[model samples]
Target: MMMNKEQEKLPLPLLFRQEANESLLAFCRESARDLPWRRSVTPYRVWISEIMLQQTRAEVVRRYYDRFLAELPTPRALAEASDDRLAKLWEGLGYYRRASLMKRAACVIVEKHGGELPRDYASLRALPGFGDYTAAAVASFAYGLRAAAVDGNLLRVLARLFRVEENVLSSKTAKTLREIAYRMLPDAKDGTSGGERYLYDGYAAAEWNQAMMELGAQICLPNTQPKCEKCPLSAYCIACAEGCAERLPIRESTLKRKEEARTVLRVTDGERYLLHRRAEKGLLAGLFEFPNKEGTLSEDEAKKAVEEMGFSVKSLRALAPARHVFTHLTWHLSGYEVTVPPIDRAALPEDFFAPTKEELYRDYSIPGAFGAYKP
Candidate 1:
């Protein structure tokens, strides 16, 4: 009874999504804690969190989420925030361009929507930094419209269930998953509305989205290590039924990781840590860090770059090699803790100045990538 990969991806019973409810309900009823944004599910909180979660882990998002919510609790506050300050707030979250695009959208809301968040799809999609997925998320969660939202996690979960070997990121797979999700959305009449719709908008937008996402994030995983026995959808999963739980999501071979070398300067005199604010553009923009030159370089090249930046390179002390893997490339960092003898104040730009260790700790936001090289 050999089955090809595509053959293994046959359609399941209509109850596939319905059967997932046990896990979803378990997560919602037993495990789901009240996240800060969960308390209100306003357009503002929904929009911000959805945007923040892009390519960023949820645990990390929790930390930034609260601070960002506090700083900009309402669309008015977000609209009022300066691009420079907003970018700074989003410093370590990476994908800096999203922050800029978000600001542009906020401006639109303030000017055109009167600081009120839009409820429909088209208007929301038109906003900068928001695409189809984000627009659907906001429309459903923020406004309770039953638009299906798809992301990597969703595609992974769906592909495995259907035993789909198609490119998970392909436009076709994405469209299929979105259609399936929308089709399987709990009816409004199932809960308590007495034939009127049972699954409320809240359930569709907030609960369903969270449940599917949490399942993907927590159980139905990417690696060949998913705990099928523990997965709520195990009973209905095509992979599980066929005793091939780990192999259903047929994805193509991964592209090679692009490697880049960065030379980090942990510039410090005896007392102060020399740090620089990256330009309000490019990578690491709006974050504070020791100066670095992109691409792997020899000690001589690093020194030349540092000297060219007007900082005297006194001594280069080696540190443990630290590697950071970004989305498309891996950064192999060879850090040398350099100490520059105090330079004349006149040698630097008026905006750049020396900050002590205390000041750097108190004020500067250094990315974790270069932290090991910190002076």
Candidate 2:
């Protein structure tokens, strides 16, 4: 790959100024996907969609966006929703914390912002789950403000466009890219109408920001080699010119995920499975799960463990083992089917509730980590 010493030292924004902006917006106007969130533009819609899009892809988010809005149409609805309903709607999205935070943020908006999202960046950032990327997204896309929202996609595009050698995952590198995005915004801001609908003339700040993100998602993909020949900004892309577009956005090596062995207890009578509501603070908070204990156990050990929990185990059979991966950890799960006498709700531990198969299907919300063992 060829190297340009001077280009490596130049700021990303200055390297691809107006020429890159026009190419990106023009490409987007012709090639942007017809996403659900883009069709109905609103501060609330953008807020929910952006939060959902974090660490998740657009295609996956498509399945949930409209349904979530259909159920919780307003901030008040979301704030007042039952935990089961919210979790059920957001089931399979993988990150339960995002759903939890969205509920909290809705309450804040209802109580403090008068049931509407604040139009300013500072106020939006103050809301739960609205980080720099999400806040700037709401400000620029929903409000037509000249704010730059730099996300992973946009970061890759900028990093490759200017051949940045800095680690893109670092906070300092993120701030630098955000500055570049701010500089790349369209020169004029038309401002929002302070309502739920918006229409841009293809060169507005919102369009520009979306265009950059779209280009990154469609052309400058992260996992594979970028389609530079089809990219509108290829002419000005330093990485393309240097034949190293695939290697520009450098990231520090990630730590290995810690492995855990777990034995999932599926204690059942004829009516319902023994379930418990997790603590309201840590991982999988407020979600339902079958009774489980750490470490894989033998059939005799499993029966003994359940008896220790104050239940008489009748029979035990080992089921298949499954694995679930989180961002920092992986759970190697061994499941067991244990038969027991009918549970007495009064005798069960606090916060433990057994739901019948029908009720579990229709009402409860279990985390994806327990999917393999879920009946």
Candidate 3:
């Protein structure tokens, strides 16, 4: 097909218009990782995997994905899942709000969508926690729709390929990059006229999107270490041609992570440990945590704090200090192991309770941030 002068002048790169897409698809066919999420290929599975992959490494997500699916296999199951069960399944993954939002979305799916993920882009996007990227991913990878699932990997790949010098983190830059990705779709040349037809041979929309993501993840790596020699798109990559692939995708964000000091109390009565349920809102919301206070407290202060909770502290020993980094905050933690005499359950604080070791490990969902202090 011949392009008009106006179309020719568009920012859509020749790489996306010609052989680069084919090269990327072929590379993925030969070299894509045998990820577990790639096996089932259901809307529910795809939705879960994409949500889990957010702000998490694929390797780490693998450990939880299968187990989570085994327990809550469908939208109805997820919507009906108990808070304890949900928290336990999602423990250590961080970003607890994702799990909560997923549950809310599952309820909506069960009630409104007939216990299935919606098949269209706009409907999927309307679901709770379903951002444009996630909605696009489910629409394309699961439903085989012509939606562009442009994530960080694709953003990096496109930025380097087009040698974009603007701050890639900005919304304008990301939107532009996403538009370019949409144009690279197989039937995008004909706009909406082709419907679900694939213009490219032996390549589905799912494969194309996954291939682009895989190339970025495996070859066009972030920082200063992109493996240009192994990149299938290297021949057409403007950044590679200019010897500036490493610096092409600029990110000039000004946000800084706030630091916080915390003192964690691992108060135990020999066999049972004290756990507190966080409030139903805010960070780590509705998850279990060790009784902790703001600011690093000395051993004496920790003992006093525990006693103030109406527990008679029998013995106190200092535990090693630990730190946990969240997306926007860093927790510098000091801890104490306080041994207390067994007390009546009624005497415990409203949101505090002591559970046996087995119960704590099996029933409670302790955040990883309290790992160093958990009994």
Candidate 4:
């Protein structure tokens, strides 16, 4: 295969190749945080943790990981979980689609792979919610397979170590970095065996990818202020040697985040709060949320809107404004608390119902976007 011109210009590192791996592993051995997933490394735990960690901070995931596993301890449990149950379990973790796709993937695992995640990269990648990074992560960490999981952190580490100047977000750069990372694998030697058992030191391959990822997350960092002075690979990093460690792995985001105004309505009876199920497909698909409209509405306007939806707004008052930022949009929300006399349950819309706050917490899966208006 012909190499990209950019990759050719900035050749992969050769000096201290083994030494760098040693440094990373040594540092990780002493300093790797005792994460819940690491404590009990299994294909199921690795898959869940990788999926949760996507676009989310590690600290935030720590609290939810244990709870999720305790509730749905196996693929069969996850496969058979009701949408509301799954959503409730995944509450407060944004990106409801991850939970949904995981449910689908769990069903696939139970049906096709006998309720255990496939140990290979291709089968793992074929499952819903399992992308290249996630698949490689589970394969390497769980199964001890020699697969390279190149995430943003790993990309930063590699780009700095080799002084790569290409945009890290570009597909070509990603492919090149994956190639570099795969070459750096501890098990890498000769021919590719299309199954388990590649060709290197047997035990170290499991730690290689995790060590790289941990180094990036803890020390390599991103932006212009990575902790290079404390980095294990600093001695081998071209970016550090050339005094440009901070400027490496150049990236530029092309898309702008659109701003939107929303009025979240909290229609409640004396005991139960009204909730609406979002459409089956789209953002926050199949999740329950408070009744809401497109633009921020005034107290009178919001109450009028709620009344039009087959309810008599006995009392209406505006609550504090809140903001929720998504990948491509920011929702500047205006919320109102509306109280109504008890209405007949049969009069409500099919997609709308009133669940007590406790019931909402235990049964319905409200998205985090409506956090400010939570009853």
Candidate 5:
């Protein structure tokens, strides 16, 4: 908790979190961002929304959030679900590890905490996928405990408001931000619960956290491109006066993806396409996909593989080539949507799969953002 001479010299009133909270709340009540998760607040619901929002847009999150809730229903249901099922649920949502770790977290609640999400900050932080932002979000939003949820949105807001220039990727940024937030807390103020002080002021905490995040996501925005005209806190924001809001939340750099060539096999038997469920662990794990090999395969080899699978390749035609980038790898993809004469029904391998045209829409979750789906 030691602050350097420079940090200690900063005026204490400048660190007031409640003032920032009030500014944001005033903005939100007058112009709250409409989101589904905002409707009902629960530990589990808020936790899922937090995970889905990581590196994903609010619109895209809205789609996944509803589907995920409908399918899993509860923590116990998610905990017991197979990795394949979980991965399938999270299909097309990159960063599959988030889904995996979330399932692991649910399992821990069942085994260690008797199916209840522990309310303590430390306990939530120890969960498999919980980072500081996520941990703080769960604490504030769900439990009503005052904490800072410093995601990208919050970081941008803080950086612009404070005019901080530190690289946000650095751990130093996280530490400084958290320290600032700590100074801002309302000193454990007493509040009513059913006309009595049951204390642990959660309602105020929830409003405070949500308002900060909402302001950041909608108004403060990345750099100076912020919609200053529509912003409610324009009068108070430091970046607004300086006109350097966009330049505030500086980041280090994004890792370069290694380019890899892949040939996706689009083997088909006239009406249905061949597919398989990939193995668990490593890239697109458990999502259904056509057989593929790194780099282009010789037509002879591709023909041989198809024949071995008990299908006669009638013709091979090239579809539009596509590309999909992941954190570590870039798939420079080429697909050959081949037509195969119907193979013997019983001869198909156990893991081998075929999807009717309608089934493509039903069964598998292809990453369409990456490339066009072909059968």
Candidate 6:
């Protein structure tokens, strides 16, 4: 591959690269946490864990991972799971679309791949919700393939190590960083001599990838808060020597979150509460939620809103205000509890249902965004 002037200046010295690799691997061997996914490494387990880890904290994914696996242990099982059951299993995860796409991919796997995750990166990338990073992760971690899983963590680590000044989020910088990661793999060619140069291979490749990620997550952190003193790669990090590790990996664009107001209603008839299923597309799709509308409503307006849905309001009381933030949206919520007489089930909207308190908690997948308002 041809190198631009910037790329030419980015390559580390060969001896330093070798020492850095050994230091990183040793650090991982000694200090790596016993994460569940690392314990029992399977293609299916890796796939599930990677998906759950996206835009979610590893600590948070821990709560859902084991439960999700216990219920749907195999691709075939996940392929056959009902929508409601799947949604319930993924209730607190927030991104419902990932669950939906996983089901679609599972169905394809069961039909086309004999109920096993495909071992090749290309085939895995073709599956729903699988991207370059995910495909590479599964290939390297699960199948011992020589693929580099270049996630944000790895990107930051690389940028700091080489003192890259470009925006790490750009495609060009990402591609260059990925190439550097690939070259650092065990038994990878150094791109110079004709002779085959072998450093390490097989499971060692997986260990190297995980070690890089662990370093970034725990020591070489982002947001001007890197713990360079504890980082294994600090000795060789160009950014560390320059006293700018925190500012090395620049991001060009910062997304502005759109704010919105919502009025949530906890309409109940002493025993059962009203729930509505969101449309099958868009944000929070297909999940059960407390009946809510787009904007804060006055107490009288809240009562009128309930009546418009064909309900008789016996009493109305305001509940505490709540807020939930998504990736690019913020919901400022106001809530109300409305007591009503028992209504005719047959007259309710097809998309609406009234479930007893016990049933609501046990069966429905009410998102945590409305947790503050749930009775």
Best by TM-score: 3
For model 3, what is the alpha-carbon lDDT of residue 157? Answer: 90
Candidate 3, residue 139: how far the Cα is off, in Å: 0.5
Q: State the C-alpha lDDT per candidate.
A: 0.71, 0.82, 0.84, 0.82, 0.73, 0.84
- Clash pairs, model 2 backbone: none
Off by over 4 Å in 2: 1-17, 189-199, 253-256, 344-347
Q: How accurate is candidate 6 locally (lDDT)?
A: 0.84
Assess candidate 5 and give its TM-score to the true structure: 0.85
Over 1-375, each residue of candidate 1 has an lDDT whose tens digit, in order, gives 112366436564457445465455455544555566676767888889989989888777888998988888887788788765676578678776677788889999999998987878889988888887898888877777767677888888877776776777667776777766665555443322232221223354445766777778778888787777777777767776777757656666467788888777666777776667777777666666777778766778777777787777888766677898765778888766676887555566754656777766655656666667766
lDDT of 2 at 194: 27
Per-prediction TM-score:
0.83, 0.90, 0.92, 0.90, 0.85, 0.90
Collision count for each candidate, in order: 6, 0, 0, 0, 5, 3
Candidate 4: which stretches are off by over 4 Å? Answer: 1-12, 188-201
Candidate 1, position 306, lDDT: 75
Q: What local lDDT score does residue 373 receive in model 4, on the 0 to 100 scale?
A: 88
lDDT of 3 at 63: 99
* Candidate 4: Cα lDDT at 67: 91
lDDT per residue for candidate 3 within 89-189, as digits (tens), equals 99978888899999999999999999999888889999999987999889888877877888888899999988999998899998888877777776534
Q: Write the per-residue lDDT of candidate 2 for residues 1-375, one digit (tens) a residue.
A: 011364346454554446666667668778888899988888889889998899889999999999999999898999999988999999888798898899999999999999999988889889998888888888888887767788888989989887899998888887777776766665653221122222454326787778888888889988567999999988888899999888778988567889999999998986888888888887788788888889989888899889998889888888899999887889999999898999887778888887888988788887889988888
RMSD to native, candidate 1 = 5.6
